[model samples]
Target: MEHEMRAEYEEGVEPGPDAEVKNWHMVRRDGIKAMCGRMLSESAATQPADRWGEPEGEPFCFLCGAVYLREVP
Candidate 1:
């Protein structure tokens, strides 16, 4: 219940210039495709899904490198 409520209220914010990025979560590639109708998933190198170990902190678009952050707690 708590998780659902938190997720419902989650809003993305752009961190300040002085803020340091300690972690990152890649935005869903599928959602991007649906919204923009463009392919940001296919990688010239390793596929995004093929990557390992998700970090914490800022949420980012893996394809475009746009970062979004939400405060937890």
Candidate 2:
């Protein structure tokens, strides 16, 4: 099946030195919005190229992961 989902995260000034950084989210492959309902930035890079192997120690959106797993075939 053709994939309809991708990984995304916030990467810009909004997450400044003082601001808490947002977690990576699983999003629709065709759009910039995350499965957790958060709208990712247009500048946010997608997976593979981002090389974000399993969220692991990195901050990630649990909600997005839950939804993504449920949606997967």
Which candidate has the top score in lDDT? Answer: 2
Q: Tell me the lDDT of model 2 at 3.
A: 27
lDDT tens digits, residue span 1-73, model 2: 1223343434555533354445666666657777788887665544531333354314667787688668767
For residues 1-73, write the lDDT of model 1, one tens digit per residue.
Answer: 0110000112343344343432333334423231112322221112243232344322433423322123212
Error of 2 at 32 (Å): 0.9
Per-residue lDDT, model 2, residue 53, is: 36
Question: Which ranges in model 1 have alpha carbons more than 4 Å from their true place?
Answer: 1-14, 29-73
Q: For every model shown, what is its TM-score relative to the native structure?
A: 0.20, 0.60
- lDDT, candidate 1, at 36: 17
**How high is the CA lDDT of each candidate model?**
0.27, 0.55
RMSD of 1: 13.6
Backbone clashes under 3 angstroms, per model: 0, 0
Off by over 4 Å in 2: 1-21, 49-57
